[model samples]
Target chain A: MRHHLILRVVTKLLIGSIMLFALYVQFHGDYSPGGGFQAGVIMAVAFIIYGIVFSLQDVQRVLPPWLVHKLSALGVLVYAGTGVVSFFTGYGFLDYAALSPHHPVHGQHYGIILVELGVGITVTGVMITIYYAFTSRTPVMDDEAW
Target chain B: MLRTRSLFATVMLAGVFSLLSALLFVTLDAVDVAFTEAAVGAGISTVLMLGTLALTRRFESPPAHTPVIPLFVVLVTGAALVYGTLDMPYFGSATAPAQTHVAPDYISRTPHEIDVPNIVTAILASYRGYDTLGETAVVFTAAVGVLLLLSGLRRRRRKEEEDV
Candidate 1:
């Protein structure tokens, strides 16, 4: 793969586009079919494809393991923290109405966005982490072996 | 065929199965579920299996025990599942129990209460927020488990270096 010129060139072109599509799926989920889980998997696919074409170390450089680990936890925090905020504002847990006192509808929108963001972030982090975990442990083999 | 096949071939077959099931989901009008099955089952799991193959033997060893008990259990489970489905409503039927239940309330009130056009999103993120939160936590735990398992590789490397 390292010496494969076509593979390298195609990967460079594909990664950016895949990432853009993932973002579209993430944000447009409310109106369309996709959501956080789909977007996250799409994002992970971009990274995994990069890893496959290049080296595992190259992908790691772009997204370090520590950052990946932190992102995974942060997503869950953002989700739970949303609930905690609503609770403190005299509402029940995950009550989006408390977000915007004047317009409860707006609050609902805000809450959905936040929750979906959390889901997206966690999914992306965990999916990438799992890929990394599997690839990193395996001993390298020659191209011919594969 | 799978029983006699190499691990790589078996994995490929499984990936194909997932892709087919994803297509089935799409035809069933479950786009989100199709997206998940295609991505997770076909894409990620296939890649993970390849990496696992890289670490270990490509061919499976012969079974050490009899398959009779496991075969019996699987047959019983399959029979029970088929029997249960006979009593269930037809797929996507309008007058199904699911459509008749509290689903009506969710559909009617979602526009006013959640103010979202996508009722699925409203239900998942607002109405069932806690359930989604729990699911997210489960995903997080799976990542943690894999990391713990793989981190042992680093320790083994260090031991080999010390031996050298």
Candidate 2:
């Protein structure tokens, strides 16, 4: 990794755009072909690419495993919480009308965005967690192993 | 691909196959599926497979059993699948059961109800929110399962090393 100057530089250049594209896909999914799932995977890919180019320790320093694990659970909570909130508002479970009693359509929009955000967070966390788990176990292979 | 013995090459070929399928999905007007297939199936899985390869042998061992029974099973499954499709409607048929089912209502009402430009997102995140919640839970459960198994292995390995 230390000697692979080209790989390192290219990864540094691509990581930012990858993250930005992930955000675009996440938030812009309401109008486009992508959503939380695609965005989350793309976001995780950025960190994974960085880990591959640099080191697992380096990436972990930026996103700790405990935090990643918590994030995975947090996303689920966020999703379920939305439904619970609707229930408390006298609507059926997961009914978006609860979010905006006056304008059900607007409620649907807000609910959709919130749920998508939850999905994106969970996916990003799980993916990075899996990557960390797999990579951390193996002793770093030398550059010539490829 | 079946003839190749190198695990690395096999993994790379699998990635290529995923990419091709993603392209096929795109051509079928299923862009959302294509985007996910391209990102997850082709990208992450390839890297993960390569990581798995690093933890194991680079080349596959020669098969000890004859391919006759496996080949028979595969052929039978393939034939059955093709036969199953024969009873279904043609591709993009207007009168297909799926097309006639609740799809029309969703298409008609989504513009006013959800008002999102992407009906897929509307269905996935709002209309079908309960199902999506279940799906998110499933992903979380899977992550938890993996973490438990892998971390347990590491702990046991460390214990063994300590004993030695």
Task: Using lDDT, give the best candidate's number.
Answer: 2
Clash number for each model: 0, 0
**Which candidate achieves the best DockQ against the true structure?**
2
The prediction achieving the highest TM-score against the true structure is 2
Where model 1 places Cα greater than 4 Å from the true spot, the runs are B153-164
Lowest-sum lDDT 10-residue window in model 1 chain B: B1-10
Candidate 2 positional error at B103, Å: 0.7
Which 10-residue window of candidate 1 chain A scores lowest in summed lDDT? A137-146
Residue A102, model 2: lDDT of 98
Per-residue lDDT of candidate 1, residues B1-164 (tens digit): 33663888888999999999999999988888898899889998999899889988888898899999999999999999999999788898889988999889999999898887778788888999999999999999999999988856579779999999
Per-model TM-score versus the true fold: 0.93, 0.95
